[model samples]
Target: MIYSFRNSGFRDPETGVYNQTYFMEVFNREWHRHIRDHQSLALLYLCPHIHETVKQPHLLEFFMKQVQEAILRTTDLVARLNNNSFALGLFNIDEQGTQIVLHRIEEKIELFNLEYGKKYTSHVDYELAGYTCTPARNLRIELIFEDVESLTHELEMEKNKHIELRQMQ
Candidate 1:
């Protein structure tokens, strides 16, 4: 929503949102703006359950729609990442605001699951990771992106540990 989707280069044709190339462009500009304005910026990286998505090809679209609806701010945006994952950016939002949006998304997703389970006898699952960049000196955009990506790995690890624990029990 940050830019006009009319330009094919700026948007992913299928998702009709910003593509990875455009995302980095905006992120770079936003990084400088964040430094100048000293405002809070939150980035969320989401990876839909690929296995489930294979069974339900529309699952990613449904999840992305929920995320888009949850983030109502004009300044907030969602972009397509590699491997069917996505990145959401919220500018001028603090940690609490970020948490609220996350909760909103989770609630919507839970509702979708409930309805889907009742009607289709299936459930959707996804992994989410978030990081907020506060006003700081000498912060690099590359590192922030890397940190969020690393968070994805950490979340997967935690999920696997839980699975292991459940198997043990």
Candidate 2:
């Protein structure tokens, strides 16, 4: 049987991205398919750290658009999780591809800052958490949701080190 999740109340009303429920359903099937094909599966959580979201109703929309442009692939899926954070399901993507996507996201943020940095006096500070799963018997399916906290914390620490290095330079 064929099914359409778009209209099944699985979409986020604000950003039009899939909600966590829909993401879980889709990711499970995609994960198995990728494993069978011996392909890599990448998941990313994109969080904006210091945005003035309460004052800007369009903040989420802009971030969503930036991510969409960066991914630019029809196969990838974006979902809004329970914590209001966004996640991307990147099928058949590798570690290098994940880094490229992150760089692109950073470039997009920089562009936005260049345009509106002085006017708003606040630039978009993003914290990204990425996980890549290669086809393996030892691979864990629960890591996607379960490891988000630790993953993001690690990412933040890495970003802090980079910031410090740049300051020293």
Please tell me which predicted candidate would have the highest TM-score against the true structure: 1
**RMSD for each model, in Å, please?**
6.4, 6.3
Worst 10 residues of 2 by lDDT: 160-169
- Candidate 2, residue 92: how far the Cα is off, in Å: 0.5
Tell me the spans in candidate 1 whose CA falls farther than 4 Å from its real position. 1-7, 52-57, 135-137, 160-169
* Model 1, global lDDT: 0.72
Local distance difference test, each candidate: 0.72, 0.70
**Candidate 2 local lDDT, 33-146, one digit each (tens):** 887888887777777664445476666767677777888889899988855478888888877787787788778877876765766767776677777766455667775555
User: How displaced is residue 95 in candidate 2, in Å?
Assistant: 1.3
Q: Each model's TM-score?
A: 0.82, 0.81
Query: What does candidate 1 score on TM?
Result: 0.82
What TM value does model 2 have? 0.81
